[model samples]
Target: MVFGFLKKRRREEIRAQPFPAEWLAIIERNVPMYARLSEADRDELLRRVLVFVDEKNFEGAGGLEMTDEVRVTIAAQACILLLRLDDDDYYPALKSIVVYPAAYTVPRKESEGGIVREDDAVHLGESWGHGAVVLSWTSARRGAADPRDGKNVILHEFAHQLDQEDGAADGTPELDRLAFYAPWARVLSEHYLALRTAARTGRKTLLDQYGATNEAEFFAVASECFFERPVQLRTRHPELYDELARYYGQDPAEGSASA
Candidate 1:
């Protein structure tokens, strides 16, 4: 017990260190919205991000070197998700982040009836429950330029980490003591169905139809939209807005909107 206590203490001490000013400035320069965070909040995010970068294993793809710029670019976006929430909890499950130079082929091998073949799948980003986040530098940078479009690779995958917390990305997590799961169910269900309908009808949707794939994707995609474009989401789907507001303990429209 004493050993465990000391280990936890050390973790907290690591989490309290100051992030380099130059690193903070780099993120702020690339991601304008990152500048909006309050000084204290900035410090806290830096603290977590600093440790997050160090703790994770990052490898370069296509000959790109792993540099502070690359890690900070990705960490800053991941930090966005943690800005309003505690750094502990579900996301702690992720221990490593692998960054590629650009979208690359993730090959999967399979056999059919007595034959075997390998298929190369092209991907920009992928998150695994085994505690790794794989991202493309190009896609990551694009997501940084504008967090309002809901296509943030970091936010999308991190939201999946949140969804996977309760052992499955089933579009739900452990809520606060006062959280109302019923409303969450109702709102998410409605929007999810709407997204499905749009996909079925081949119509463009406010929330990406990728959300229609499953309950978990719906939750993650909705989270991207929730933080990225809350006003639009709330105006179009007020019920979902209310539900997410209660769920995340945030009114993103408060911090991100221009009145």
Candidate 2:
């Protein structure tokens, strides 16, 4: 309890410090979504970013050098997910971010007919239940630069972070109340099944086909589409979009219209 209070006090101090000019310039230049946010939301996001950057340990791997630009750019995108959430701990389960210069490869194991095969798989980002997120800086930057692409590695991985907060990545994060779960499960499951059918039939989809992998992936992928392609998601999948908007406490489609 004492340690928690100290951490909270430290976070308050960090939040009180003025946001640096260079960080604002980086957000303006790298994250297009920043321009679309209302001034109040922008200020709130900046406060979250400050605490996020201060609390999380950032390390560069695969020959990349860590810098303020990399840290602030990633923090801004990650904190956008928390802008309206009632949580004060930020990502309580997250401890560090590991960034690579570009896409990196990890070992993959596949089992077919009772035989297990190991191979290398390339990835842009991954979120672990053990309090770490790995990202490729190149992909992260691209996602931030093209806010309408419906694919942001930082957002996707951080969504997984949210999903893991309750000690499980079952496509459901910690909702504000127990009452919110039924609707959330119903809507997301409907869309998940639809996406799976669409993927099997080679039909085009607004939400990423990768979401069909499972419920956890569906939530993360849906989160990416929620913020990046809000207008399209709202138009095509109103039910799915509504669930996300209710959970996130923001209407990006409305923001898009005003923008």
Candidate 3:
């Protein structure tokens, strides 16, 4: 009861404030993906972003700093994912978004006490436990500007969050009902294994090799493709595309066509 009241009160506080008009303009102009949503959906999404930006705590790391531009920029992109699915309400689970100036490295240990850093490896975004999203400003802008290339930092990170919500990044999120799980497992398993095998054999495929890392990554990478390259993903891996369609309850290719 106490937590619910606190959340309600906080939302009320945010509802009273206004978001920057310039940021909303940016979202509409830069993200054609957002333009596909209905006007009502767009209004609701902007409202959600308004509250979402207010709800989460943002940390600017690696010399980055938080500003309304940063918050609105990130929030608009993140909220775009919710425009088409059940993602919005659950996103409060992620309370912090750590933004770096560019693609920051998560250093790994090398053999024989050697340190190696690959500065050119740029990851646009990542999401972490307790509702944290990390992103690079440059990639974020480019991603929103062009959604057709099957690469989106915000969608990519939020896909990670969806996988993590069930307490494991196991290439699955909690389904609406138990019945949905059987087909989900069946289709995802088949496609996941195929992609994994293809990755090893160096076969050409639509999904990125990063998906080969695990089921979690498979879900995230596939999700990036699912939204950005909907027609391509649907054609390349129809079963996986169908399962994601069932799960997300939206079809981007279909949606885009109607638009």
| Order of quality (TM-score) | 2, 1, 3
How many residue pairs clash in each candidate at the backbone level? 0, 0, 1
Off by over 4 Å in 3: 9-19, 84-89, 110-124
**lDDT-based ranking:** 2, 1, 3
**lDDT at residue 39 of model 1 (Cα atoms):** 66
The 10 consecutive residues of candidate 1 with the worst lDDT sum are 83-92
lDDT of each: 0.79, 0.95, 0.78
Model 1 C-alpha lDDT versus the unseen true structure: 0.79
Give the per-residue lDDT digits (tens) of candidate 1, residues 71-169: 888877777777766546327688878888899898889999999999898998888988888888898888878867867777888888877776877
The runs of at least 3 residues in candidate 1 whose Cα sits more than 4 Å from the true structure, single-residue gaps closed, are 87-90, 108-118
- Candidate 3 lDDT, tens digit per residue, 1-259? 9988887788767656675688777677777787777777778678778888767888888898778777777787677666666653547579888888777767453445475544344466777766678888777777777878877787888888877877887989878789989999898888889988998898988888788888888888888888888888888789898888887777777766677
Pairs in clash, predicted candidate 2: none
Model 2, residue 28: what's the lDDT? 95
Question: Could you say which candidate leads in lDDT?
Answer: 2
